[model samples]
Every structure is written in structure tokens, then in C-alpha cells.
Target: MSVRRLADDQVQPAKFAFNRDFAAQAKVWVSKYPKGREQSAVIPLLMLAQEQDGWVTKTAIEHVADMLRMPYIRALEVATFYTQFQLKPIGTRAHIQVCGTTPCMLRGSEALMDVCRSKIHAEPQHLNEAGTLSWEEVECQGACVNAPMVMIFKDAYEDLTPERLAYIIDRFEAGRPQDIEPGPQIDRVFSAPAGGLTSLKEEPKPAAKTKAAAGAAAKSPAPTQAGKPKREGESETLGTSRPVTPTDQKDEANAQSKTGKAAASRSAGAKAPAAVSDPARPAARKPAAAETVASVAGPATPATAGLSDRSRPAGIDRPAAPDDLKLISGVGPKLEGTLNSLGIYTFKQVAGWKKAERDWVDGYLNFKGRIDRDDWVRQAKALAKGGPEEYFKVFGKKPR
Candidate 1:
């Protein structure tokens, strides 16, 4: 490793502080750690300081040590140890780090080094004539599969020929590095087959049905008979029994007595008043059978099931007054309306969401962990109570 120290007094500012933009970001990073452990945030602060000015400077290191409340040497130790922190002045517009590892070397990285030497300076880390560009040969940048790559700041330009590398440097020097796209120079995706995918080029065939699945299908009753199937160990008897008990005989006698009285009254020529069926014996309207729309596709996932339930079908009435769902930080007007349309109107409903329900909503809304990330339930509970007063009591501030 090259010697890493603060630049000469002429090169560094007398004092350094994070600019407003960086101050705000630094505050956020610092807040992530527990109290009195702010020193843990030193590495990121140093990186931010370096990012603010093209590289780490003496004043920047002291500024970070003060911000983190650590000793100057602690901050300096970190700055010197990580190769990522450039201790000297780097090119203001672009500082290129070329990978000179074995894989890159084998793939004509030497030619790239030659290109750098011819175009910029014979010594690495020296600025070009314009002072807008500088480069250094570094160890493996971990994109060896895309060997012969150069990283300008955060972006990696991979699969470079000498001509391509020269073009990239020229573009950066001209203050338009954005003109050159990153990644493989040839037609390929990151580390995939160079030319194109050689295998699994077509859609995969459906897996063969297992014997257990086939047997289950065979055992399933026909659709018409889905309502009833024979119970285990029961005979196929239709309204037949072995013998009558004493209680049955008594019930039969009572029934005969009622029939005799009715016959006698009819035979006596006495017209009985028009009769109505007993309310207790009135005909019943059978309930509709449980409907099943068998999908030709396959079994439903829990996510899909939740989506189906949450999707409001036509003819369901919208609530007269929907709750203000935007009280939750991430719930913008469009998302609130979407939630309302899906019948999730109130914060109470959102607050009640379990992990499974949240997962379902996440899938339904095409969100990637936004619910947990924003602590939607915590916010919703506060909103449902009344407003952010309760939220402030719990979380110490207003919702984002």
C-alpha cells in the first residue's frame, strides 16, 4: 500500500465542517447508533467527508473526529487503513481506480495500464494535463468476471479494450462521463454468458406430476357428489333400521290416535275449517351451496388469496366518509385512494395488520418492505387514536 497521510499544509483547508447537505445526512447516519456509541459512525462520516471534497484531507479527518467525539488518531487510523479513502488530492472531476488483479491482468488489463500511462501520467495517481482526471492501479475490485474494468468514483466501467478505456477517460476529462454507459462493453449482462445465454434459453417444461398428486386427484369425488360422500364403516342403507325401541312404539301410537280423530271428524260430515300448514312445518328455502371456481392454473398462494379478498368487487358500496389514510407517512393520496378502493379505509384497520396481512398488502401493493420500513402499524395506531400527538409520545416526533 502507498503511504497514506494528510496532504501538505498548502493542499488542505485550515478548518473543515460538513456542508449543510452532508450535515443532514450525517445526522441520519449518527442517529442509527445507540447513544454514546456515536464513534461507530466514524467510518461513514469519514467517507462522507471524503465524498464532499474529492478525497480525505487533514481538516476533514479532524472535523470527523470532532463530530464523532473520538481522538484524531482514531479517525486517522481508519482513513489510512482503508484504500477507499484517498489521503492525497484526487482529480476533482474523476478519479479512476483500475483493477490490476490476476483475472484482469490475464484479460489485457496490462494494455489498459498502458493506455492510462500514455493518456494520463506515467506515474499512477498523477493528474492529467487538464487536472480533471487521474487514475491508479488497485487490487481486485471484485468484478473479475467482468475483468479489465475501471471504476470512476462509484460507477464501474467493465470489459474494456484499450480503445474503449481511452474513450472513457476522454469522456470524463471532457466533463461528460455520463455519456459512457457502465458494465460490459460487449453484448452481455453482469457476469452472465458473454455472447448470450447458452442453456435454459427457452421456457422450462412443466414438472412431471407426482404419484401422490395423481392419487389425490383420483380419490377426489365427482363435482356432483362433492356435497356428500360415504362415511367410513357406514353401510349403504337408505332410511332403514334394524329394530324399533319402546319409545318408537309410543310415538307411533300417538300418531295413530291423531289420524283416527281426523278420519272420524271427516266421516261425520262436519266440514273442517280451511287448514294451513303449521308454521313449524313450513317449507324451508335451502341455503346456496358453497361455490368453488376451480382454477385451471394451480393452487392459490396465501398472497394471492389475500389479494383476492382485498380487491373490491363491483357493487360494494364505498364508505360515506373514508378515514384520512395519508396520516401514515408513506400513504400518499394515490396510495390512500388505492387502500380505500381495497376496503382499507381507516388507520385502525391498518394498525390491526399482522405480519401475514402486511405481507399480503405488500404483495398486493407491489411494495418492498415499505410497511415495516416506515413502521406503518406504529404510525397507524397513533393516527387511529386521533393524530400525531400519540405518535410523538411514542416515537418522539411527527411522521415523516
Candidate 2:
């Protein structure tokens, strides 16, 4: 609800001549709707002005108001209702908007916000002193599959923790393309079944059509032939209904006849049992299995679902890549798996990872790999200490 309105001068007004073409475009946009429904075009018109000028100016709002035949206040209403419209000014290069919605909050959004707060040197909606970075806390931008996310310009950074998030923001600030990372930045696998299992099977569908139905629809043309009578010896008493074949449809005329109940019966007779476990077992919850094995903890610390309780908050660290995995010499992939299993998923998590915690995971995973070799705990210590260089100082060199 609280937004920092950038000073008017922060964003310059668009050149004067630009309005001529912008009005043309708005007219074109307005024409798309039914003759009298000009109001429906308010969103797109405002969007075009924002796109052209970087931020919406009062003059542009007036322009839209005039074009749509509505009062200026009405145009302003449409613009302000959506965060997409910037009223005052914003950083031209990077405008990072973090999601503080339920899902992102539930999965460490605040720690991510902490990274934003430190790196941008301002809280949400406040531009950093350098005028290159600004962030705002907004509602869901639809990346819940990879929650704890932020929107940088038009692209999304998902599955974030404070560590991975900090590096990502720094990379953008340094003029690096933030497109390097793939999948969600966190443990989620694009909305996997619990524990993220995958399955491919057919179930009875009451109303929904299937690939088979679609193919049938495409192939067959006329259900009733103009001249041919029902085939002799084909008694309706058979109780086997044939899918309607389009007699007019040359290609599908025979497709339906060939793939009847006989074919279905044959497939049903040979179908194999699926390998997925039954519901009532330990594997009952798929994502839960992977969640176990670490932190032997309890109910989440008392706070709202998206809110974390922080007397003193610790953040996670990121190694930048799998090659950095060796930094924690003892935390080879196997130990890493145990750590992840124990809910200790990232290096920053490992860095914030307490010594007692490391001992616990080391003991639990029976770590033959000596994680102490890389000093990941200390490395994480420095990450919580400050920015990028301080982060790399612990490892003795910066990541390229």
C-alpha cells in the first residue's frame, strides 16, 4: 500500500512531437472494440504511452483521457490501479519488482528483499542513490511455480533465496544479462507433483476430449451418409456404439470404424500397471520425501505464512555454479543431497549454515567428503556481511 513516488524531475517528459503518433496508435487501439466501448481501451492506451515515454507523464494521461473521451481523472484511475504504469519516474535500466504475495512470502521473500534493500540501497519502490536501481513490492506476477521471485523489467527471476537473489541483482547492475540461470532458482521443479513426481497416463474423462477424440474430429466429416443404409447384420443390439464417422469426411470415414470398442478392448487387455506408489505410504507425499533428511525441525517459526520471524535473520549464499560445489570440499553431490534432503538447499543456506548444523548433516550423511576444505560456512559468513566482493573474498577470488 505504501509506494515511494519518484520526484517529477527523475523521469523526463517525452519529446513534444511523440504525442502525434501516440494519439494515432491510441485511436487504432480504441477501434478494436465495439463502436461505443471506448472505455475498454484505457489500459492499452496508457500502456502505449508508458512504453513510449518510459513513465507516464501527466500530459500523456491527459492525452489518453482526451482520446478515450473520458475525464483526466478517469484515465489516472486506470493508470494507477495497475503497478505497470509508473506515474512519476523510475530507473531506466533496472526496475526490479519483488513479489510479496502469499507464495513468494512463504518461500523466503523477505530475505530476498533484504538482498534488494542492501544492494539497491533503498527499500521497495525507492530508487538507489545511484539512480540505476529501484525496486517495489508488488502482487503476484504469476510465477508461483517458482515462488520467492522478482520481476526485473519484463523477465522473471524465480525460485529465489537471499543468496542467489543477491548475485542475480548484482549481475544485472553490472550490465550482465540475467538470463543465465535456468529453471526456478530454488528447489521447486516447475510445479512438480508433491516431491515433484511426473506421470503420463490416461483416465476416464466424463466430458473432456482426448487426443483420440481430437483425431477423430479432424478425420471424420458426415455422420450420416446420404445414400448408404446401415450395414446388414450390424444389429443395434450389439450394445457397442460406433463413434460417428463423417461420411462426407473422406479421411475419417474409415478411422472411426477401425478404432472401435474392439481396439479399446485390446488395449485395455494389455495395459501395464503404473509404477507410481499408492497414496497411503511414506512416499505418499512426493515432494515431502525430498524435504525430509535435514534440519529435523518443526512447525514453521510463528509468523504469517509469507512472513518470516526475524530477531536476527541469516541469509543463504550462492556459489554461482556447480563447479563451485567443490569449495565445500566435504559437500560433494552426495552430501549436498543429504543437506538438501535436510532442507538445507543452497550454499548461502550452507553459509548461513551453522557449525552445529554442518556437524549434524555431516554426521547424518556420513560425509566422507570433507566439506571443511572449502570453508563454505565462513564464505556464507561474509555473504551475510556485505555485497559481491566481500562475498567472493572468502573464497579467495571472485567468480568470473
Model 1: residues with Cα > 4 Å off, grouped in runs: 202-400
Q: Give the per-residue lDDT of model 1 (tens digit) for 162-276.
A: 9999998888888897898888888888789899899999999899999999999898964323345545432223222335556666776787899999999888998768977
Query: How large is the C-alpha RMSD of every model relative to the true structure?
Result: 15.8, 24.7
Taking the tens digit of each residue's C-alpha lDDT, what string does model 2 give over 1-400? 5653433754555432346655566666677789778888888877777777777787777777777788887887777778888776667668878898898899888887788888885556667887778888888888786787888766777777788877777777778864546447655556664355456546756897889999997876433343333453332323223543444344454556776866888888777778897678766445565467434665565332121323222433433442243344344556565454444545456666556555554444455335465566776556546534555444433332
Largest TM-score belongs to which candidate? 1
The window of 10 residues in a row where model 2 has the poorest summed lDDT is: 304-313
TM-score computed on alpha carbons, candidate 2: 0.46
Q: In candidate 2, residue 12 scores what lDDT?
A: 52
Q: Report the Cα lDDT for residue 315, model 2.
A: 32
Backbone clash pairs for candidate 1 read none
**Candidate 1, residue 29: CA error in Å?**
1.7
Largest lDDT belongs to which candidate? 1
